[model samples]
Target: MTLRYHAHKPLRHHPGMPETRLAALLSDVIRRQRQLHELNQRRLAELAGVSQATVARIERGDRSPSLPALERLLAAMDLQLTIGVEELDAHLDARLTEQAARPLAEVLDGLGLDRIVDRLGDLPYLLTGSTAALLQGAPLPTDAVEIAVRWRDSARLTEWLNAAYAQRWNARWGEYGGVHIEPEEPGEHRWLTRHGELRAQMCDELPAGIKVRHGDRSYRVVPLVQVEATDPRAADLLRRHRQRQQAAEAPAG
Candidate 1:
C-alpha cells in the first residue's frame, strides 16, 4: 500500500529586526530548501518563473529578493513567510542599547588600543581612516584600527607596535598613500585580535586636538575633516559610512 506523509510545520519569525538582517535570514531559508530538494538555480528559477541569475543572487546574499519573488520561490517548496510582532528580550535589548551608546574611549579600551597608546607614548598620533569615521558618529565598516603619526615617527612606531603586539613589523612602502605597517603574527593561532594592519602615515600634516578625553587618559582620533581632505578613497569611505548610518536609522518594516 502507498502511504503519504504530512509535512513539518513552517518556521515562524518575529519582527523588528533590521531589514538587512531579515533579508539574510530569508536567504538562508531559501538556500536550505534548494539543498534539501537537490535543486539547482536553474531548476528553482524554472519552478518560480524567476531568472536563474535572480535565484543565484538571492542564494549568494548578493541581492535581496522582492516580496512577490520570495513568496513565489517559497511556495514552490510548499513554504510561506510569516511576520508577527513579538516582544524583544529585555536583557538583550538593554545590552544592545548599552553597547550602541557606549563612549568611544570605552570602545577603544575594550579593543585594547588604550594599552597600545599607553605603551607607544604620546607621539602626536591620531587614529585615522574608517575607525576615525566610526568614532565621529558614523557606522562604518572598519577592518582594522588605522592610525597616523608624523613622517619622522614611522620607524620608532613600528618598533613600538611590534614589541607591543609580540609580532614582527613590516613596512610596506607606498601603500594607502603612505607606508603601511603590518604586524606579522607567528603561526595560525591569530583570533579575536583584529587581523588587519594599523596604517602608519609619514605625512608632515597630522591633525591635532582630535583626542577622546576619558578622565585621566586621552586617546587620539583622526578628525573627520582631515579624512575628507585626504585620499579620494578615504573620502568615499566616509560617504559610505554615513550612508550606512542613514540606512540603519531608517524605519523597520
Candidate 2:
C-alpha cells in the first residue's frame, strides 16, 4: 500500500517528529515484532509486565506508550528502540517520481503481470487500486498489482497460485506457508511468490469493470471513477494530477 504524508509539521516538543506518523510506525513495529516472536497480546503483556488491554491498545494505535513501557515491551522481544533522523519524504518522493516517469506497461512487465494473468487462465478478476488506476490511464505509480476476486473463487485461485507459482499465503509478519487462503478480516489476503507479491481483495462479488487493452492483452479493470472513490492513494494521485493540469492551463495566472 502507498504511504500517505501530511504537510510538514513538526511536533512542538519533539522538533522534527511527525506525531501521527510516528505513532503509526511505532504501533506497526510493536505488533509485527510481537507476531514475529510468536507471542500473543496476553503472552507479550505477561513478559513485559503490562496489561493485555494495554498491549491491545498500543497495537491498535489508540495509545502511545511511555518510554519505560515501550522499552519493556521491546526488550521482551529481544529488540531495542532506536531513534534516527533523515529528510522526511525525500526517499519516497524520489521513488514515486521515478515510478511515475515509467510507462505502466513497463511496470507491469517488470512485475511479471502477463505471466500471472496467463497462468490464472479462467479465474475471474478485476484489477483494483492503483493498478486499476494505472490500467485506466491515471498515470499513478503502481508497485504491486491488486485484484478483486469473489470469495467463492478464492480457494480455486489459491490452489492455482500454489500449483503454478509456488505461492505462499502471508499469515503474519515474516510468516508464510499456508495452503489455504483465509482472511482474518474482510477484503484482504496476500500471497508471496518468486514472481512477485499478489494481493487479493476478497469480495462477495466482483465489482463492475471496464475492459482495457495493455500490450495486446485485454484486462478488466476497475473504472477510474471507482478506483478514485475506493482507493485513497489513487484518489490523491489523480487529484494532484488534475490540479497540476488545471494550473498549467490557467493562462499564466
Candidate 3:
C-alpha cells in the first residue's frame, strides 16, 4: 500500500538558497536519492537521465546540476526532497493521513499500475526511495508499493510477474494502503533500481500483513517471529515502533 508524506504541497521550496549551498544540497540529495533507490553507478546513471560517470561526478559535489534536471531525477526515483525552507520540519501529516485512510488498491489501481515487487519471491529487490519509505514506515506519497528486484535473467521478471504464489493473498481486502501482489510480470519490469546501494535487506520473516488460511477454515498472518525485521526498508517503522514502546515504558509525566 502507498502512504502519502506531508511533503510537496504545491511543491514549494524554502528560500535563501545560495548557488553554492544549492549545488551542495543537490549533490548530496542526488547521492542519497540514488542510494535510497539502490541504483548501482551504471543503472542509476541511466534512470536519472544522466551518464554513469556523470552520476559519480554529481555525487562528489564536483558538478552542479540544474534545478529542472534535478527534479526529473528525483521524480524518476520517487523522492521528494525539501530545500531552502524556514521550516524544514513543517509538514501536513493530516493530508497524507487522509489520503492513506482510503483503500490503497482503489486509488492505486486507478493511478496507472506499475510493476510490483514481491519480496516473498525468489527475486532480489534493490531498495530505495519510496520503496525505502514503505519498508521503514516513513511517510510517502500515495502510490503503488514498489521495490527494485533483481531477476536472475531480465526475462525472468515477466515470468514471475504472471506466476501467482501458490498461496492466496489472505490480506484483509483494503487493509493495506497499497498492494504488491506477488508473482510479478517481467516484461513490465522496465526499470531496475540499483541494488544494494542502499543496503536494503530481506525481511528475516514474513510481514505482518502476510497471512494464510488452514483447511479448518482458520486464518493467520505471517507470524511476528517469522517476520524478518532485518529489511532496512522497515527502518522508519521500526524506529517509530521503538519510540512508542519507549514512551509506554516512561514514567507518567
Candidate 3 lDDT by residue in tens digits, 1-253: 2222223243324465555655555665665456556665567657767766666666656657766666667766876544434543222333345545656444333323222332225554433433334333333443334434443433444444334221212122201112342334211222222121111112333233433332332222323322234334344434544555577799997
Model 3 TM-score on a 0 to 1 scale: 0.33
Evaluate model 3: give its lDDT: 0.42
Task: Point out the higher-scoring one by lDDT: 1 or 2.
Answer: 2
Each candidate: what lDDT? 0.57, 0.68, 0.42
Indicate the residue-level lDDT of 137 in model 3: 37
The Cα RMSD of model 1 versus the native structure comes to 13.5
Model 2 segments more than 4 A misplaced: 1-96, 165-180, 183-187
The C-alpha local distance difference test score for the whole of candidate 2 amounts to 0.68
TM-score of each: 0.43, 0.61, 0.33
Give the least accurate 10-residue stretch of model 3, judged by summed lDDT: 192-201
Q: Which residues of candidate 1, in runs, are more than 4 Å off? A: 1-110, 165-197, 214-217, 231-233, 244-253
Q: Whole-model lDDT, candidate 1?
A: 0.57
Best by TM-score: 2
Query: Distance from true position, residue 121, model 1, in Å?
Result: 1.1
Candidate ranking (TM-score, best to worst): 2, 1, 3
The residue pairs in collision within model 2 are none
Which candidate number would show the highest lDDT if scored against the true structure? 2
User: What is the clash count for each candidate, in the order shown?
Assistant: 0, 0, 34
**Model 3: residue 53 alpha-carbon error in angstroms:** 6.7
